[model samples]
Target chain A: EAGVTQSPRYAVLQEGQAVSFWCDPISGHDTLYWYQQPRDQGPQLLVYFRDEAVIDNSQLPSDRFSAVRPKGTNSTLKIQSAKQGDTATYLCASSPGLGYSQNTLYFGAGTRLSVL
Target chain B: AQSVTQPDARVTVSEGASLQLRCKYSSSVTPYLFWYVQYPRQGLQLLLKYYSGDPVVQGVNGFEAEFSKSNSSFHLRKASVHWSDSAVYFCAVRNSGGSNAKLTFGKGTKLSVKS
Candidate 1:
């Protein structure tokens, strides 16, 4: 079975530059999530989707961060104006459903971003 | 709101020694719990999960966690350590009592094994 896939694995941007991270979730997965992990810290949820509709995006920075999963199979997270604080590993995970206890999130290698 | 706490930021032990990683949680009610491990330059992988019923759940790589409702804790334990087991371990909780809340993670504990 193929796992969740993300690209480009690494990205570097100067302040105010824009960047987009892409994710391809596992086949048949109904839930997709995006998280941000700072250095030596745990991942923080940025946004999530269930079959092309956003389930929650409360943590996403409205001013610069935007995510879309129009086809329900792939997703894209965009940062309009990158800042140093946005320099974190962008992680994408997928699960079968949102059944609370039954959901087991499978993650991708993540895109390590560095905003100068 | 649901939250997780990993009391130990780091732990060191010899290869043959036993290991235990502590986790505490706070929520309006007992939530679904989980443990995950992350290898160097890799993403998080599920170790185990607990919702209800038995207080103990077994996970991959000989890992197991015991949930204690009274203490509001779920601690990960291994019979003996291996060098390959050195990684960052994260404890998480979901608002599984009723809501569709997402999994919340702790700061994580970095385990180091000495051969």
Candidate 2:
């Protein structure tokens, strides 16, 4: 089976520009997540969805960051007016279900975004 | 609420040397602990997980971790490491009971295995 897939392995943009990342989770997986990983840091949760319904997004920078999983299979994370601090790798992951036993997430190669 | 801490930011070990990566978590309840490895641009991969039962849990590629409730730690260990073992390892924890729980990650420990 194919693993979680992310598009535009690399992306570069100027400050104040916008960029969107796309992700296709492992087939049949019901939970999807978007995380931002800064250099020398661990991946931080930005947003997540469970079958089309957002579970948590408090960590997401509401003013500029937004994410959606309309059909609950694929997800898109968008950053409006990107900042230099936004230069980080965006990772997408998916799980089989809820709870600890179902918490294993399969991740994609990630979208490396750079704001010039 | 739950949080994970990886005290070591970097660790270097010669090939065929034993290695251990420390991970500590803070949670009021019985939390779910996991260790993940990231290779350069690649995404994080599950190395091992601990939920309940025997403390020692083995994972892929000869990696293992022991969970200790008293210490609140889940440290990853390997009998011997190879050059391919070089990567960034992250320790994460999630509330075992919650409606919408998310895994909290640590700063990560970069292991550089020398041949």
Off by over 4 Å in 2: A98-101
Which is the leading candidate under TM-score? 2
Docking level for model 1: medium
Error of 2 at A106 (Å): 0.7
Residue A89, model 2: lDDT of: 96
Model 2's chain A TM-score stands at 0.96
* Candidate whose lDDT is highest: 2
Judge candidate 1 against the unseen true structure and give its global Cα lDDT, from 0 to 1.
0.92
Task: Give the CAPRI rating of model 2.
Answer: high
Q: Write the per-residue lDDT of candidate 2 for residues B1-113, one digit (tens) a residue.
A: 78899999999999999999999999989988999999998999999998889999999999999999999999999999999999999999987866655888999999999
iRMS (Å) per candidate: 1.2, 0.8
What's the true lDDT of residue B101 in model 2?
A: 56
Computed on C-alpha atoms, the DockQ of candidate 2 is 0.85
Q: What is the lDDT of residue A101 in candidate 1?
A: 28
Tell me how large the interface RMSD of candidate 2 is.
0.8
Per-model TM against the reference: 0.97, 0.97
